[model samples]
Target: MFVLPDDDDRQFAVTLARGLEMLRCFLPGERMLANRDFVERTGLSKATVSRLAYTLTELGYLRHDVEARKYRLGGGVLSMGYPLLAGMRIRQIARPFMRELALQIRGAVSLGMRDGMNMVYIESCSADKRSDTRPDVGAVHPVLRLAMGRAWLAGVGPEEREVALNQLRVGVPDQWQRYRPQLDQAMRDFAELGACFSHGDMQKNIYGIAVPLSAPVDSETLVFNCAVMDHTPQARALLDDVAPRLIAMIANVESAAGLRQTVTTTPPRYPRR
Candidate 1:
């Protein structure tokens, strides 16, 4: 579930919010869920979950499996996203660049935008066709720990970043404590190195470098990330080899998108081998 608006807000639609939150209970791997599962995941009463599930099923947002007595997301949910993705022109412009970088690094490149307190990948490219863990277009990741998220925070205005930080602090206190220092370092890196680096902070064997676009697209700040997954993580190689290329790739993307002439950043020179 995501952060709810203040209870006192007069125009907030409680039932609608609850219904949407129910949909969010479906994770990537878990496809089907019973009313009891919704109750446990959403903290809504069984009766409320039942009503919402039935309503959503009627609306075509969910499909009820009579035999399995479970619910799964329906075509309506996917249809809802098509317009949003289609409207994001930046994704089209960035895909070629992202694919090139992914192939060069033999890793994954993704473009994402903030969704509530998390970041959702709008586009992803991976060189490894057979890798099970390749980032997918709809995958969501926390904003506090990942390089893509940190770069976003680094690029945004201070007031916006502060508001997001306050939300994270209240919503996930443990994560705030564990990743705050790393986020601070990432901010410095963004200032000095033109990108933010995640040295296996997101996942045990994954390293990433990310940079935010110089300008927002359709008033939405977007971030691009390049991730390398390996059993033997190499932080220096990410900084010295991957970071420069990722920065340049973002610069080229920004230029192509006409967001700016080009990104102006003091990217570190690639280390001579």
Candidate 2:
């Protein structure tokens, strides 16, 4: 669930936050949602949901479906994202490399950054054109569960990392309790293995290895990952081959983007848990 700002905050706009939160009710893979759906997802009153939905539809942020009595994200929502994507020179610089690596490993390679308590995919490349399993751009995954998110959590400064951890501990206690051990292991893996691994954890039959960029991009922490959808015995052996390749790729990206002094394969140091 997306968290909203406190209503009492001096700078917080209550009605604006409510409308935006209503928009966030649409999850990935969902095409349309009715007012009742928003109410259920957001814990808002039926009347409030309807009002916000109508307002969003009128403002061009949502498209109304008269026949279905539902709404889908509109062009205005998509248009807002273009500027962000266009300004990310790293995304443009990393795509070709991501494509090459995706082809090499016959898997999917992605670049992502933290968004609140989740990691959102900014770019993704898949080895198979027809594969539906690979995450598309804008896909969000829990930070405590997936390799990409774990890499971001592992790469940040201790203070920022602790703040996020505290948020998780308080914001989503059940998830934090369930996945805490895996989070600890991820930190150790980053410090010792140079990459973090997630096998059949975040999603079933998925294998992933991720490493954070050696340096921040535009003051944002970025993570690069390779993911394969497989549950066979061969998946175990993928770690060794993919880890070094991912590290090499991160070094290349950091060098090309001028985010580091020199291209080095040494992993970023993570705080000992």
* Model 1 ranges with Cα > 4 A deviation: 1-4, 230-238, 262-273
Each model's lDDT: 0.84, 0.82
Q: Candidate 1, residues 106-166: lDDT per residue as tens digits?
A: 7888999998668999999887877533677888888987899999999999999889888
Clashing pairs in 2: none
> Which residue pairs clash in candidate 1?
none
TM-score of each: 0.89, 0.88
lDDT of 1 at 37: 88
- Model 2 over residues 218-268: C-alpha lDDT tens digits? 899899989887754465565567777778777777788887667755444
Clashes of each: 0, 0
Angstrom error of the Cα, residue 211, model 1: value is 0.6
Q: Which of the numbered candidates is closest to the native, going by highest lDDT?
A: 1
**Cα TM-score of candidate 2:** 0.88
Candidate 2 at 119: error in angstroms? 1.5
